[model samples]
Target: MIVWSVLIALAGAFCMALGSALQERDAVRAPGHSVARVGFLVHLARRPRWVIGTAGAGAGVALHLVALSGAPLTIIQPIGVTGLLFAIVLSALFNRTRVRAGQIAAGTAVMAGLSGLLLLFPHSAEVPQLSIGTGLGLTGAILALGCAVFAAAHWVRPGPRVLLLATVGGAALGTTSALARVVAANAAADWTAVFTWLTPMCLAAAVLGGLFQQNAYRTGHFAAAYATLLVVDPVVGAGIGALLLGEGLPTTPLNQVLAVGAALLALGGTVVLALARNRNPEALRAVADRDEPTATKPGNASPGARASTTTTSGESR
Candidate 1:
């Protein structure tokens, strides 16, 4: 079951990466002001790449649900970060983009750190109840944050600049996933819970997080955006789950020490990816440059020919 879940999640990562590439292909050409929802559906219908990408996303989600059914959220969330590394690989393969050795190394560090946490930390066997007030409050906070991120995304320069928004989105998703766990365990019906404040927040987080992540991929360094969003979001959610909800840590001093160490490891990994990316501004420039429409594919057309092209790229991210 674990193996199948892992494979499914990894496949989902592949789908997500493909979707980003396809969406980016169009988003770069469209004016920045276009409605993202309309742009996304149109792009999906028009681009075979996007259709495949969307299918990948569906496959991934299906797999993710399977994983959730069997494993604890902490175990599953960290593993989900594998998609970030997967995104880097898929982007290289499909988009003809390059993944620097440093990017790979940093991503590996994050994976290693997250994996260490998973192995050392015991799963919560006790099902948690989702408090209605807590759920509502958390959801409200996430919605406000999402709006802030979208508004803020516009002000920031394209590139790694959008990573913050992606991180926020990721955090929102992570938080909601945690809430979903509690709700699933306690609520009479998950749909009934949806009418409460928590549902909208979770939905918004998933949607906006997806949007923010898509934009981050389109305009930011691949590894940096992927790592920051994937790693940090869940970590923040986990922190909230543990601290606020009183999810117990390992009892032994050594286990406790290791848990803290794992947190640092993840944090260090995030910093490493960020630093490596900042040092390689050229890579970021490549992403941001590709985000806007160009007349021709690299080496395929002259500058004058590109200037005359009428292709309109559009998407929310």
Candidate 2:
């Protein structure tokens, strides 16, 4: 079961990577003011590419549910850290750029560190328990945190804004993972378990996460946004698993120290990726502009206008 879960989760990671790449391709062209708002999702929903990308993401979620049904949350959740690697490659391909060595090394570090930290936790078969009070409290806390981050993103520059949005997205999705584990476990026993409070909470969290994810993509910093998301998702999920699901980590001093080291490695990798610049920013900008309306296309603009737009875009990134 564990082996099968791993394989399924791997496939899910690829789908998620594909989804993120496709979504980011269109998201970067969205009106910047609309991001982090409901109007943003409404606009993307009209675009066929974004719709297809949403489908891919939905498929990935379904596959993740299947994987969660078979394996402990700690073991299964960390598998998603691999999606950062796939996302890096896919983003490069979409942007018509080559993947840099630094990106590869940093992505590897994030995967390794997050994977190590998660795998160090002791797995358990115990069923997850979530009382109504605890569930409500957790849900409220996540929502509050997301709102706070969203508000803060507005005052920051694009790079820091992307990271803040991704952080909230990851936290919400991590909460979703914990809730889904309980839902999956219950559904396995009684299919009617799908009609529960936790199910709605899970869906709400997923939606919140998805919104922030799109906002991050809109910032046009794929590596930083994606690396942050991938790192935070598993870290938050593992915390929820250990605290709420009874999947505790090693109690040994050596193991605890190693886990902290792994976490620091992941943090360092995320910072490196965030600082890494795109190799061909102009090319990427051109490709993204292709999705804009004909009236807004660079070809339609005067030389001075085009130059101004370019400067603005550069500063925003």
Candidate 3:
């Protein structure tokens, strides 16, 4: 069962990577004014590629849940770090670009650090539990933090904005994972668990996470955004698992030191990946040209002028 869980989790990671690549391709074409808003998702829903990408991500989540049923979060969550590597390859393929050596090295660092940190978490067989009050508090805190980060992203440049959005997205998804554990445990003991506050909160967090992810993609930095999200998700999930589900870390001093070092390594790797360039400039230019306004009204300009403007815009990125 454990071996099967590992295989399933790996497959889920690939699906997630494919979904992110497809979604990012369309997200970059969304109107700038619509980003980070409800309308942004609504707009994306109209695009076939985006819808297909969403389906892929949803399928990945389903497979993750199945894997979780057979293995502890400690094992299952670390497997998700492999998604970053898959995402890099998929993004390069979509853009018709080569994956640079620096990107490969940085991505390997991220996966290694994150996997080490997750593996260090001590798994518990204790069934997860969450009271209504605790569930409400968790939901409120996650929503508040997500909103604050979303607002902050507006003040930053495109690069920083992607980081900020991805952070919130990752946190929300982590919370979703933690809550799902509670709900799944309870439901196994009692079917009425579906009516618990945790069920709704888990769904809400998943939706919130998805929204922030799309916003991150809108910045057109797939490597930075995806890398940050993957790194943050497992860290946040492991922390929540420890705090809320009794899956604490090892108490040994050596393990503690190693855990801290692993965390720092993961963070450092995330920063390096963020600084690395992965997408092709021509792909970005194509997206810009496609999104350029077609109207001849004031500020819209003719096709030639719009082409020139799109070229400049792509260059600025």
Instruction: Report lDDT (Cα) of residue 205, candidate 1.
Output: 58
lDDT of 1 at 106: 73
Off by over 4 Å in 1: 1-30, 33-48, 64-80, 155-160, 187-197, 250-252, 272-317
Model 1 clash pairs are 26-313, 26-314, 28-291, 28-293, 30-313, 295-306
TM-scores of the models, in the order given: 0.69, 0.82, 0.84
Assess each prediction's global lDDT (C-alpha) against the native: 0.60, 0.79, 0.79
- Tens digits of per-residue lDDT for model 1 on 229-298? 6666656666666765666556799988887887677767766665553322233333323433222354
Error of 3 at 223 (Å): 1.8
Best by TM-score: 3
The clash count of every prediction, one per candidate, is 6, 0, 0
lDDT (tens digit, per residue) of candidate 2 on 203-307: 888888888988878777787788888878877887988988888877899999989999989888887887777522532454334332212357688988876
Model 3 over residues 46-153: C-alpha lDDT tens digits? Answer: 999999998998888788889999998878888977888899888888888898888888888888888888778787778887788988898899999988887666
The lDDT of model 2 is 0.79
RMSD of each: 7.2, 5.2, 4.2
